[model samples]
Target: MQITHLGHSCLLVEVAGRRVLLDPGTFSSFEGVEGLDAVLITHQHFDHLDPDRVPVLLERNPHAVVHADPESVRLLADKDIPARPTVDGEPFSFGDLTVTPVGAQHAVITEYVPRIANVGLVLRAPGEPSLFHPGDALDAEVPAVDLLAVPVSAPWCAVKETVEFVRRIAPTAVVPIHDGLLTDPGRGVYLHHITEFGRDGGVPVRDLRGAGAVTV
Candidate 1:
């Protein structure tokens, strides 16, 4: 499987002769991207689902299907995007890839803020390593995967919690995500700590900040 990080949590994943784009939001660009088989959205947050860019993405990839949680499906329906609502444990297939939706809610931001629906995805294809992308939540019940997109930084998470989450998942390798708010230096520090802690746990973490296409 080939995964290209398109900034923040956006990933263009190519496997089993199919292309899947995950979370093309305000922090990332889906410009010039086409011929996608599926677009998997985790939630309704602007940082994870851009209202303006999604229409353009649909224009570019006319055949691609949009899949999201129920709340996001409602929002997309209002925009006339027509997204299919996904439930936990339910699997959706696109060509040779089978994507199973997991989790039901986003992480809590604060006591006053109401939590929204979020669904992480577990992707599997023939002859390729399994992968999981856990949207904005850290406590989702993710299955074992070869490649895990770890949320290294977020409003609901800290460096220690991120490290512990990685240890709990224990994927073969980890790719940092949800880091759009970090500056270069702050990103450096977080990456260093994550790498160190991941090393201690016998897991290698790959930093995809500027580099692209890490194969698994």
Candidate 2:
């Protein structure tokens, strides 16, 4: 399995000849990409939704299966894409991949009201270990994850919290995300937290913003 970081919390995972895009918004770098087998939306936030990109994506890959929260599913129904609505704890299969939705909460406190449901995806590929993508918050419990994508900032998260979350999950490796809001020269906060957490614990941390790759 291969994982490519496409900015922010967005990531493209390729496994078993299938491509799975996760939260391709909020500084997403997957602008002109094509041939996606599945798209997973964690929540309905604009940074996560990226309506402008979804339409084009659908046009490029009409057969691409989109799995998202109920609200996101409703929003994408108007498009020609083959979208599927998923609920927490629901497990479904797509080719050699099996996805299990896990509940999560967006930490933002706005009056707009998060009418959308938030969730994390647990993807298990044939012969490969299970991978977890905990979208926004780190308030969920997972068992035996080989690879874990964790958010390190925004609304509610710090270096301490990140380290604790990683230790609790006990994943084989951890990837830091949710830091694209900062400019190129303004990534001190996120970097500091990530570095501190890495130092505090023995867990290996990958810098998703860079060109490095993570293979599971």
Candidate 3:
């Protein structure tokens, strides 16, 4: 399995001849996101949804499928995409992968109602360890994996929270996300904080700089 991090919460996982993109933000349409076989959206948010990009994606890959929670389905249906709604505890297959939906909470907004169908994904890759992407929540019991793409930012995610979260999961390798895409690009410094968080928890952290790509 090969994984490419397209910044923010987006990732491109390629196995066999199929490619699955997870939580693709505007980055997908930017470049390197064409020909996707499937997409797994964690929730409905401007950055995660990127409605402007879907139509182009559909045009490029007519057989591509998009999977999301109910709220996301309703939101996409208005846009005329063939989106499949999913719920927690439900499992589905895409190529050689078996994906399981895990519960999560939406990122807190000051005045907006949180999208309640937020989810984390547990993708079991053929001949490789299962990988987990914790959407907007950090309270989940991390599943075992060869690689764990854990979120390390957002106002609610502090150093202590990351420390505790990593300790609980104890994945072989940990890569940080959801931090570098801040409104103020200077906040990229916060990624440095992840090292201490992992040090305190005794979990090894992988560097997320550049376009993160690794063969698992």
Output the lDDT of residue 70, model 1. 93
lDDT of each: 0.88, 0.76, 0.72
Which is the leading candidate under TM-score? 1
Error of 3 at 163 (Å): 2.3
The segments of candidate 1 whose C-alpha lies over 4 angstroms from its true place after superposition are 199-202
Clashing pairs in 3: none
Q: Choose 1 or 2, whichever is better by TM-score.
A: 1
Q: Using TM-score as the measure, what is the rank order of every candidate, best first?
A: 1, 2, 3
What is the TM-score of candidate 2? 0.86
Tens-digit per-residue lDDT, 1-216, candidate 1: 888889889999999999999999899967988889888999989989997789989899999999998999999999899999989899989878899999899998988989999999999987899989989887777767888898877888889988888888888888888889999889888888887886464578777766777776
What would you estimate as the lDDT of candidate 3? 0.72
> Model 3: what TM-score?
0.85
Q: In angstroms, how far off is 1's CA in candidate 1?
A: 1.2
User: Considering TM-score, which of the candidate structures 2 and 3 is the better prediction for this target?
Assistant: 2
Q: What is the lDDT of residue 56 in candidate 1?
A: 88
